[model samples]
Target: MGTDMGKKESLLFCLDRFLDPWFGYQLPYQDAIVDLLQVVIVSDNTLSVKEAALQLICDYAWPPFPVLEENFERVEAELRPDVSYAMHMDKEIETDS
Candidate 1:
Protein backbone atom coordinates (compact mmCIF):
# COMPACT_ATOMS: atom_id res chain seq x y z
CA MET A 1 0.00 0.00 0.00
CA GLY A 2 2.86 2.35 0.71
CA THR A 3 4.24 1.80 -2.75
CA ASP A 4 0.79 2.38 -4.23
CA MET A 5 0.42 5.59 -2.27
CA GLY A 6 3.81 6.75 -3.44
CA LYS A 7 2.93 6.03 -7.02
CA LYS A 8 -0.32 7.93 -6.66
CA GLU A 9 1.45 10.90 -5.12
CA SER A 10 4.06 10.86 -7.85
CA LEU A 11 1.42 10.86 -10.58
CA LEU A 12 -0.48 13.68 -8.90
CA PHE A 13 2.69 15.70 -8.58
CA CYS A 14 3.52 15.20 -12.23
CA LEU A 15 0.02 16.20 -13.27
CA ASP A 16 -0.03 19.29 -11.10
CA ARG A 17 3.43 20.49 -12.09
CA PHE A 18 3.56 19.49 -15.74
CA LEU A 19 0.28 18.35 -17.28
CA ASP A 20 -2.03 20.70 -15.41
CA PRO A 21 0.03 23.74 -16.28
CA TRP A 22 0.44 22.73 -19.91
CA PHE A 23 -3.05 21.48 -20.77
CA GLY A 24 -5.19 22.82 -17.96
CA TYR A 25 -5.57 26.41 -19.15
CA GLN A 26 -6.68 25.63 -22.68
CA LEU A 27 -10.19 24.57 -23.69
CA PRO A 28 -8.96 22.36 -26.52
CA TYR A 29 -6.74 20.32 -24.20
CA GLN A 30 -9.34 19.85 -21.48
CA ASP A 31 -10.32 16.44 -22.83
CA ALA A 32 -6.71 15.37 -22.83
CA ILE A 33 -6.36 16.40 -19.23
CA VAL A 34 -9.48 14.52 -18.34
CA ASP A 35 -8.18 11.48 -20.16
CA LEU A 36 -4.90 11.67 -18.32
CA LEU A 37 -6.69 11.95 -15.02
CA GLN A 38 -8.83 8.95 -15.88
CA VAL A 39 -5.69 7.00 -16.60
CA VAL A 40 -4.32 7.93 -13.19
CA ILE A 41 -7.51 7.00 -11.41
CA VAL A 42 -7.80 3.65 -13.14
CA SER A 43 -4.14 2.83 -12.69
CA ASP A 44 -4.64 2.27 -8.97
CA ASN A 45 -7.18 0.03 -7.31
CA THR A 46 -7.01 1.92 -4.01
CA LEU A 47 -10.22 3.83 -3.31
CA SER A 48 -8.45 6.61 -1.44
CA VAL A 49 -6.05 7.19 -4.32
CA LYS A 50 -8.90 7.26 -6.81
CA GLU A 51 -10.84 9.69 -4.60
CA ALA A 52 -7.77 11.91 -4.29
CA ALA A 53 -7.38 12.04 -8.05
CA LEU A 54 -11.06 12.91 -8.43
CA GLN A 55 -10.75 15.60 -5.79
CA LEU A 56 -7.74 17.05 -7.58
CA ILE A 57 -9.72 17.28 -10.79
CA CYS A 58 -12.65 18.88 -8.98
CA ASP A 59 -10.47 21.38 -7.15
CA TYR A 60 -8.04 22.31 -9.91
CA ALA A 61 -8.47 20.92 -13.38
CA TRP A 62 -12.20 21.48 -13.89
CA PRO A 63 -12.13 25.20 -13.17
CA PRO A 64 -10.81 26.39 -16.53
CA PHE A 65 -12.87 24.00 -18.60
CA PRO A 66 -15.74 25.26 -20.75
CA VAL A 67 -18.77 23.43 -19.36
CA LEU A 68 -18.52 23.48 -15.62
CA GLU A 69 -20.81 20.85 -14.08
CA GLU A 70 -21.12 18.71 -17.19
CA ASN A 71 -17.41 18.18 -17.55
CA PHE A 72 -17.12 17.28 -13.90
CA GLU A 73 -19.87 14.71 -14.14
CA ARG A 74 -18.62 13.35 -17.42
CA VAL A 75 -15.04 12.98 -16.23
CA GLU A 76 -16.09 11.53 -12.89
CA ALA A 77 -18.35 8.95 -14.50
CA GLU A 78 -15.69 7.97 -16.96
CA LEU A 79 -12.98 7.62 -14.33
CA ARG A 80 -14.84 6.00 -11.45
CA PRO A 81 -15.56 2.40 -12.26
CA ASP A 82 -17.82 1.73 -9.26
CA VAL A 83 -19.73 4.99 -9.32
CA SER A 84 -23.05 3.41 -10.17
CA TYR A 85 -22.65 0.68 -7.58
CA ALA A 86 -21.61 3.17 -4.94
CA MET A 87 -24.58 5.40 -5.70
CA HIS A 88 -26.94 2.48 -5.57
CA MET A 89 -25.56 1.31 -2.21
CA ASP A 90 -25.83 4.85 -0.83
CA LYS A 91 -29.43 5.08 -1.90
CA GLU A 92 -30.19 1.66 -0.44
CA ILE A 93 -28.61 2.61 2.88
CA GLU A 94 -30.44 5.94 2.84
CA THR A 95 -33.81 4.30 2.36
CA ASP A 96 -33.08 1.69 5.04
CA SER A 97 -32.17 4.30 7.60
Candidate 2:
Protein backbone atom coordinates (compact mmCIF):
# COMPACT_ATOMS: atom_id res chain seq x y z
CA MET A 1 0.00 0.00 0.00
CA GLY A 2 2.79 2.37 0.87
CA THR A 3 4.53 1.62 -2.41
CA ASP A 4 1.34 2.24 -4.32
CA MET A 5 0.93 5.59 -2.59
CA GLY A 6 4.47 6.55 -3.42
CA LYS A 7 3.89 5.71 -7.04
CA LYS A 8 0.72 7.77 -7.18
CA GLU A 9 2.46 10.72 -5.60
CA SER A 10 5.26 10.48 -8.12
CA LEU A 11 2.83 10.34 -10.99
CA LEU A 12 1.02 13.39 -9.63
CA PHE A 13 4.27 15.29 -9.36
CA CYS A 14 5.12 14.48 -12.95
CA LEU A 15 1.66 15.52 -14.06
CA ASP A 16 1.99 18.80 -12.21
CA ARG A 17 5.24 19.51 -14.01
CA PHE A 18 3.78 18.56 -17.38
CA LEU A 19 0.73 20.76 -16.83
CA ASP A 20 2.38 23.78 -15.21
CA PRO A 21 3.31 25.44 -18.48
CA TRP A 22 -0.21 25.28 -19.85
CA PHE A 23 -1.92 26.93 -16.92
CA GLY A 24 -3.31 29.81 -18.97
CA TYR A 25 -1.89 29.15 -22.39
CA GLN A 26 -4.06 28.19 -25.30
CA LEU A 27 -3.29 24.95 -27.04
CA PRO A 28 -4.51 23.23 -30.19
CA TYR A 29 -4.58 19.83 -28.58
CA GLN A 30 -8.10 19.51 -27.27
CA ASP A 31 -8.23 15.76 -27.65
CA ALA A 32 -5.08 15.16 -25.65
CA ILE A 33 -6.16 17.36 -22.74
CA VAL A 34 -9.54 15.71 -22.51
CA ASP A 35 -8.05 12.26 -22.62
CA LEU A 36 -5.52 13.01 -19.91
CA LEU A 37 -8.18 14.50 -17.64
CA GLN A 38 -10.44 11.51 -18.05
CA VAL A 39 -7.64 9.23 -16.92
CA VAL A 40 -7.05 11.36 -13.84
CA ILE A 41 -10.74 11.48 -13.02
CA VAL A 42 -11.12 7.70 -12.93
CA SER A 43 -7.73 7.05 -11.36
CA ASP A 44 -7.74 5.91 -7.72
CA ASN A 45 -6.60 9.14 -6.19
CA THR A 46 -7.55 11.86 -3.72
CA LEU A 47 -10.59 14.07 -4.22
CA SER A 48 -8.56 17.30 -4.31
CA VAL A 49 -6.40 16.09 -7.18
CA LYS A 50 -9.44 14.89 -9.07
CA GLU A 51 -11.13 18.27 -8.57
CA ALA A 52 -8.07 20.09 -9.86
CA ALA A 53 -8.07 17.96 -12.97
CA LEU A 54 -11.74 18.62 -13.48
CA GLN A 55 -11.16 22.35 -13.18
CA LEU A 56 -8.44 22.18 -15.82
CA ILE A 57 -10.74 20.27 -18.13
CA CYS A 58 -13.40 22.94 -17.73
CA ASP A 59 -10.88 25.65 -18.38
CA TYR A 60 -9.64 24.24 -21.66
CA ALA A 61 -12.70 22.35 -22.86
CA TRP A 62 -15.46 24.74 -21.81
CA PRO A 63 -17.30 24.35 -25.11
CA PRO A 64 -18.03 20.84 -23.86
CA PHE A 65 -17.06 17.82 -25.86
CA PRO A 66 -19.40 14.94 -25.05
CA VAL A 67 -16.83 12.94 -23.12
CA LEU A 68 -15.54 15.99 -21.26
CA GLU A 69 -19.01 17.02 -20.15
CA GLU A 70 -19.82 13.50 -19.05
CA ASN A 71 -16.70 13.34 -16.92
CA PHE A 72 -17.44 16.82 -15.55
CA GLU A 73 -20.90 15.72 -14.50
CA ARG A 74 -19.50 12.68 -12.76
CA VAL A 75 -17.14 14.76 -10.68
CA GLU A 76 -19.78 17.39 -9.92
CA ALA A 77 -22.20 14.75 -8.72
CA GLU A 78 -19.63 13.36 -6.29
CA LEU A 79 -18.66 16.69 -4.74
CA ARG A 80 -20.30 18.24 -1.64
CA PRO A 81 -19.32 21.89 -1.63
CA ASP A 82 -21.57 22.91 1.24
CA VAL A 83 -20.75 20.15 3.66
CA SER A 84 -18.08 20.03 6.32
CA TYR A 85 -17.24 17.75 9.23
CA ALA A 86 -14.92 17.76 12.20
CA MET A 87 -11.69 15.82 12.00
CA HIS A 88 -12.29 12.06 11.84
CA MET A 89 -16.05 12.55 12.11
CA ASP A 90 -18.41 10.86 9.71
CA LYS A 91 -20.93 13.70 9.61
CA GLU A 92 -21.39 17.30 10.67
CA ILE A 93 -22.80 17.96 14.08
CA GLU A 94 -26.01 19.91 14.56
CA THR A 95 -25.73 23.08 16.58
CA ASP A 96 -29.16 22.62 18.18
CA SER A 97 -28.75 18.91 18.82
Candidate 3:
Protein backbone atom coordinates (compact mmCIF):
# COMPACT_ATOMS: atom_id res chain seq x y z
CA MET A 1 0.00 0.00 0.00
CA GLY A 2 3.00 2.29 -0.11
CA THR A 3 3.58 2.49 -3.81
CA ASP A 4 3.30 6.16 -4.77
CA MET A 5 -0.44 5.82 -5.13
CA GLY A 6 -2.49 8.81 -6.25
CA LYS A 7 -5.04 10.36 -3.90
CA LYS A 8 -7.94 8.22 -5.03
CA GLU A 9 -5.84 5.10 -4.90
CA SER A 10 -4.62 5.89 -1.46
CA LEU A 11 -8.12 6.54 -0.23
CA LEU A 12 -9.40 3.27 -1.68
CA PHE A 13 -6.46 1.38 -0.27
CA CYS A 14 -6.96 2.89 3.12
CA LEU A 15 -10.64 2.07 2.96
CA ASP A 16 -9.78 -1.50 2.05
CA ARG A 17 -7.60 -1.66 5.09
CA PHE A 18 -10.52 -0.61 7.18
CA LEU A 19 -13.24 -2.66 5.49
CA ASP A 20 -11.21 -5.84 5.64
CA PRO A 21 -10.87 -6.05 9.38
CA TRP A 22 -14.02 -4.05 9.99
CA PHE A 23 -16.01 -7.16 9.10
CA GLY A 24 -14.44 -8.94 12.05
CA TYR A 25 -15.79 -6.15 14.19
CA GLN A 26 -19.21 -7.54 13.19
CA LEU A 27 -20.09 -4.48 11.19
CA PRO A 28 -22.39 -5.83 8.55
CA TYR A 29 -22.96 -3.24 5.82
CA GLN A 30 -26.67 -2.50 6.01
CA ASP A 31 -26.90 -3.27 9.69
CA ALA A 32 -23.88 -1.16 10.49
CA ILE A 33 -23.44 2.00 8.39
CA VAL A 34 -27.04 2.71 7.55
CA ASP A 35 -27.99 1.93 11.11
CA LEU A 36 -25.41 4.34 12.46
CA LEU A 37 -26.58 7.08 10.16
CA GLN A 38 -30.15 6.58 11.29
CA VAL A 39 -29.26 6.88 14.95
CA VAL A 40 -26.97 9.82 14.49
CA ILE A 41 -29.67 11.59 12.55
CA VAL A 42 -32.50 11.19 15.07
CA SER A 43 -31.11 11.19 18.60
CA ASP A 44 -30.78 14.52 20.36
CA ASN A 45 -27.72 13.50 22.33
CA THR A 46 -25.48 12.51 19.42
CA LEU A 47 -22.83 14.56 17.74
CA SER A 48 -23.85 17.66 15.82
CA VAL A 49 -23.50 17.52 12.07
CA LYS A 50 -20.21 19.35 12.42
CA GLU A 51 -19.19 17.11 15.25
CA ALA A 52 -20.11 13.95 13.35
CA ALA A 53 -18.22 15.21 10.36
CA LEU A 54 -15.22 15.83 12.52
CA GLN A 55 -15.57 12.39 14.02
CA LEU A 56 -15.82 10.84 10.59
CA ILE A 57 -12.63 12.56 9.61
CA CYS A 58 -10.91 11.66 12.82
CA ASP A 59 -12.23 8.15 13.18
CA TYR A 60 -13.19 6.87 9.74
CA ALA A 61 -11.95 9.25 7.08
CA TRP A 62 -8.91 8.41 4.97
CA PRO A 63 -5.93 10.53 3.98
CA PRO A 64 -5.19 12.03 0.53
CA PHE A 65 -8.70 13.13 1.27
CA PRO A 66 -10.54 14.60 -1.69
CA VAL A 67 -13.23 16.22 0.39
CA LEU A 68 -12.77 19.45 2.28
CA GLU A 69 -13.19 19.01 6.02
CA GLU A 70 -15.77 21.76 6.35
CA ASN A 71 -17.90 20.31 3.60
CA PHE A 72 -18.06 17.15 5.64
CA GLU A 73 -18.63 19.35 8.64
CA ARG A 74 -21.70 20.76 6.96
CA VAL A 75 -23.05 17.34 5.99
CA GLU A 76 -22.52 15.70 9.36
CA ALA A 77 -23.97 18.77 11.02
CA GLU A 78 -27.40 17.40 10.13
CA LEU A 79 -26.83 13.84 11.29
CA ARG A 80 -29.37 12.35 13.71
CA PRO A 81 -27.89 10.22 16.42
CA ASP A 82 -31.13 8.40 17.10
CA VAL A 83 -31.56 7.22 13.56
CA SER A 84 -27.98 6.15 13.24
CA TYR A 85 -27.73 4.68 16.69
CA ALA A 86 -30.65 2.30 16.50
CA MET A 87 -30.01 -1.43 16.38
CA HIS A 88 -33.17 -1.71 14.36
CA MET A 89 -35.11 0.93 12.37
CA ASP A 90 -38.62 -0.31 13.13
CA LYS A 91 -39.02 2.63 15.51
CA GLU A 92 -37.46 5.51 13.60
CA ILE A 93 -39.60 8.32 12.24
CA GLU A 94 -38.41 10.63 9.54
CA THR A 95 -38.84 14.00 11.21
CA ASP A 96 -38.55 15.91 7.99
CA SER A 97 -39.85 18.93 9.77
Best by TM-score: 2
CA displacement after TM-score superposition, residue 36 of candidate 2 (Å) = 1.0
Per-residue alpha-carbon lDDT of model 3 for 1-97, expressed as tens digits? 2223254234444444454445554445623443343333333332444244334433442332323321333334344342233222322334432
Q: How many backbone clashes does candidate 3 have?
A: 21
For model 2, residues 1-97, the per-residue Cα lDDT tens digits are: 1336556546655555445555654556756766766666655567766666655554434333344334444444464231111111222233435
Q: For candidate 1, what is the TM-score? A: 0.39
Model 1, runs deviating above 4 Å: 1-5, 19-30, 39-44, 63-97
Q: Model 1, range 38-94, lDDT digits (tens) per residue?
A: 555545356666776665565454333333223335444554444333324445656
Instruction: State residue 56's C-alpha deviation in candidate 1, in Å.
Output: 2.0
Which of the two candidates, 1 or 2, achieves a greater lDDT against the reference? 1
Off by over 4 Å in 3: 1-47, 69-97
lDDT for model 2: 0.49
Reference-based lDDT, each prediction: 0.53, 0.49, 0.36
Worst 10 residues of 3 by lDDT: 82-91
